[model samples]
Target chain A: MSSTDMLQVISKNGKAKRGAEPNLPKKTLLAMYEAMMQTRLLDERMINLQRQGRIGFYVPSTGEEAAQVGSCMALDDTDWLFPSYRVPGLFLMRGVDIQHLVANCFGNEADLCKGRQMPVHYAFAEHKLVSISSPIGTHIIHATGLAMAQKLKKDKGISAVYFGDGGTSSNDFHSGLNFAGVAKAPVLFICTNNQWAISVPIEKQTASETIAIKGEAYGMPGVRVDGNDVLAVYDACKKAADRARKGDGPTLIELMTYRRGPHSSSDDPTRYRGNQADEWLDRDPILRFRKYLEVADMWSEKQETELIERLKAGINAEVKKGEAAGQPSLETMFTDVYANVPPHLREQYENLVRDEGTGHEPDPDAAFPL
Target chain B: MSSITMVQAVNDALREEMRGDDDVVVLGEDVGINGGVFRCTADLIDEFGEERVIDTPLSESGIIGAAVGMALYGLKPVPEIQFSDFIWPAFDQITSEMAKMRYRSGGQFTCPMVVRTPYGGGIRGGHYHSQSPEAYFTHTPGLVVVIPSDPYDAKGLLKAAIRCEDPVIFLEPKRIYRAPKMDVPDDDDYVVEIGKAAVRREGTDFTITAYGAMVAVALEACEKAAEQGWSGEVVDLRTLLPLDEDAIIQSVTKTGRLVTLQEATKFCGFSSEISAIVAEKAIDVLEAPVKRVSGFDVPFPYTLEHVYMPHADRVLKAIEGVMTY
Candidate 1:
């Protein structure tokens, strides 16, 4: 009786019920199901590759695909995505090429960032994916900056920032949220409450009953959604996105999802809490949406099999293409740090080139002005 | 032109910039009615009204974050950190957020703002108030750091910073705020661009490169050496970013001996930056290694305030050391 009936459409019974909200149009529901499947397969491949030592490091959005893809589907491509480290699923949904993802994952020559950053740190400059950095909450402050610019440019656009519940405790987060609140910047802040920051839990992170309620102090509406239910998250984000585009200011949407996988390839969720993360598997976002698709006569086992086979082939092709580009050599380390490579760096670069000659340079002939 | 202290010149520039640009705003602790602890914001709240001249809470992060917000909102926000030493609380906001906002956003945004803070030792303000921490901000990207040496440059450069399209860290030489008085223009639009250096005195013997209070100290040392027939040229590096390497290289090339002076601790200070430039670009031009007369790495002490700061005597000694070598 206590909060059993929240924002959900296809309940856990695997049957269509009378009282639940009506399903969406066939195309829309099927697309959501497709995105969830792709996210799961992509994340699974990356995790396995990491375990095989084929990739450097990775942070997966495994159990939280519904939170990421569902929220992204609500956003327009013109809107911005200022994500932190752990949201590769968002980039995939935002139309990042699977091969480009593999290139970045391998830190290869064809990577857009030129192999400067670690794997899983993807940035789609043309698609409005603000470059992701390794820092925890720094991107939140930048989201405020971008929202401010959007308002100044009178673009009538919104910026949705993604971070975990843990980042809400950082100074940059506090300053960013406080600034956004005061300026009434057009932004949709989606906190993917995966419930664990590495090993720390939501209880230790804040004493507040819920992270969304903290948005009240900033003078904005806060909405909570059942992060496992794709429809709930999608509906909440759509509403928030609309409010932002209409210049109604910001909205804080707390998606109560779970990180079913380990925090990263390097982490072990079992080291801290075992059954909680594994239990979320039964409520797997991808499976739940699949069930919804089947019940609504939008999907079938035959179509599911074909779609997965296509995704696997696509991923394999990207891996081969990325490996063909090869890793950056040593000289790659020295560029893109500053507008002009200052004389000190130049001298050091020359010294390094002289010290090792062309044999050790990362990209010897690749020279360009800043 | 009327004679006023360096601090007043800064205050006059802020007042004029606000009057000129309707978007200009001033915010900080004690910066409103109290005219700031050093009176830099004196009469500002009265002239500009409360909205433009805001007195904010003691939170440095809040002040800087608010300023960045205002800048993004199409307003020119100039926040005061009160003292360079107290700026650490806002370091995250400045370094991570404000500095990289423009570049990270791929030029989609810009922060035309300023963080004004008093720096250096002379008032015995101990470790808390007397530290010259401009080195911290200078190391950050997208931040234009400028430290004026006298009244004239302070007025010109501050107007420049107020009009700049990037975030500027204006470090006022607290030690020389009232030390030397000079003629600063009243109201006409004048600006010294960032990345340019000024030759305070031209000579062919020893080239002394310095900024902020050390520029005054270098000038004093130049005069003292001139009495002993040791000709000296003094360079006041007004802007640290886009550093005037051309002027510095020219002077060091001409004199064949140079002395770099700063109040910051010797390690990783601007002095080291200048030295690296000289070493990399014009290694053969030096008669002796570029001698750095900087404050020791020890924390700025209240008791030995005079000894701790880079003084006129240290300036002269460093120059003499370079000249003799």
Candidate 2:
């Protein structure tokens, strides 16, 4: 009954608990498994690529796939998403091409962001997913605001924002949740409690029993779920989405999970973490979900092995295409400041063009020495 | 054309833009039934209804955060911050989120919103209500900062800002909201382009560059200079960011002297940037060093307000310093 108690459906042994059968179509469940498998493969491959110096950076979403993919599946195509750095599963679920994502990592010309942002800081307007910003919890307010706009227009669409346990401690998270509560904006605040923010543990982040309880202070229903259970995550997110579409206010769902890898390729978990990764590996969401499907007579070991081979070949082709696109042209710096370049920017651009291949024009009256 | 106060001009611009574009919505604290604390959004709710004229909670961050969302969702949100002093709560949303939305998103997203707030020190609202925060917004790259000196410019620039594709910080000079009413064009489509300065007066002796309420102070200082046999030209820098550098350079070239005035703290203020620009480009033609008249680096105090603010006397002194150097 307490909020800290995890809301779970499928048990670790792949058995459905009392009144917890999600009744999802066999095809739908299999699709969820495939998406999770793809995410797992991409996470592993990207890490290898980053370590191999083929890509600049990567943020692996190994343990949190169920939370990311399940919640993403709950929203309609018209709904907007404000994702953080670790939600590549959400992007993949949105039907974004794997090549486009790899291109972003390469900072290639094919990258829509044009090498402006980091590898996993992806965005797609066509899919209505707002770009992921590096600043933690900053997108919560944006998600709230976007939902408010939808509410004003009497649109049934809602916004689902994803953050981590580290994000719940930020002022932006408070401001965003409080506003959504006051405005009665249709929004779902999804906190992927992976138990660590780079180096800081969740115990150090908050004294509260769970991040979901923090939603009560902001006048929203808070739910905690076994994030490793795909059925539980999907059920909770679907209920929250239904409430938002029905004019109910925001809901905060804390997906309880763990980080099964280093925070990013740049980090060294060995320095800070001990046996946690090994411990979480046993409760791997993908493996547990695969057990659920296999118990239901829907999935087999051969199917998974085949799916992985297909995903690897697909990922390899995409990585090769992304690498071949190369970096964006050097002339992209002066554009996009405004819809129309003003005269001053035009002059500066012209100056750069005139001084091509030479060093920048030196200012004789430089405020400080260069 | 009709004679109107700065507040009326702002109100007219909002009404006109909302009438023209259904996507344009007005929102802020007390912006609905209360019609804004300063009446800048008076009766907008009555005309546009509650959906468009949103009365948000007393949360500056919420107002801006929601406005950014609305803009990102293909709506033109003109959010009022009530007072410039109270905008700090939403500063993160404005600078990091709203300003960077375009560039960071690689042009796939744009926040075409106008943040309107009454600023400057004159009505003795104490420190909490009297601060010029344009320099902070101007420091940002993707944002356009607009400060209009009079009713005509206020109406024109607000309309222009609403039409601009990028985010704009429209600073309304609260001190002159009702003073010196001028005839503003009634045309609904009239707009003063952003990033352009209006030369209010032309002279041969020296250049006085100012904007918002200080432009009036500069005009008074120019009057005093005329009595002293010194001619002065006044350039109203309607837009602060993407500054009208050409206008500054031309005025300084003709007069060979520059005097910049602003109500914000002089340290790293807009006046400092303008002074630096003139000094850098027109240094050889200058008859004297560029002089800056600005508020001292101190919190706006309740009493001794005049001493804290840049007044006509200070502008005149700067003119004298620049002319006689």
- Report the error of model 2 at residue B139, Å: 1.5
Q: Write the per-residue lDDT of candidate 1 for residues A44-155, one digit (tens) a residue.
A: 8877777766677777788788888888888898888887766766777777777877888877878776676667767676777776666677667667656765765678
Whole-model Cα lDDT of every candidate shown, in order: 0.79, 0.88
Per residue, candidate 1 scores C-alpha lDDT tens digits across B85-166 of: 9898888888876776555443445567889998888788999988888788778866788998888888899899888777
lDDT of 2 by residue, A206-311 (tens): 9998899998899999999999999999999999999999998899999999988888888888789877689888799998988888888998879888999999
Model 2 spans with C-alpha error above 4 angstroms: A358-370
Kept native contacts, as fractions per model, are: 0.10, 0.64
Candidate that scores best on lDDT: 2
Off by over 4 Å in 1: A1-7, A14-24, A149-155, A244-248, A326-336, A340-370, B1-59, B62-80, B96-116, B138-144, B155-168, B175-191, B273-290, B320-325
Name the best candidate (by DockQ).
Answer: 2
Cα displacement (angstroms), candidate 1, residue A285, comes to 0.7
Deviation from native of the Cα of residue B51 in model 2, angstroms: 2.3
- With candidate 2 superimposed using the best TM-score fit, by how many Å does residue B53's alpha carbon deviate from the native? 2.3
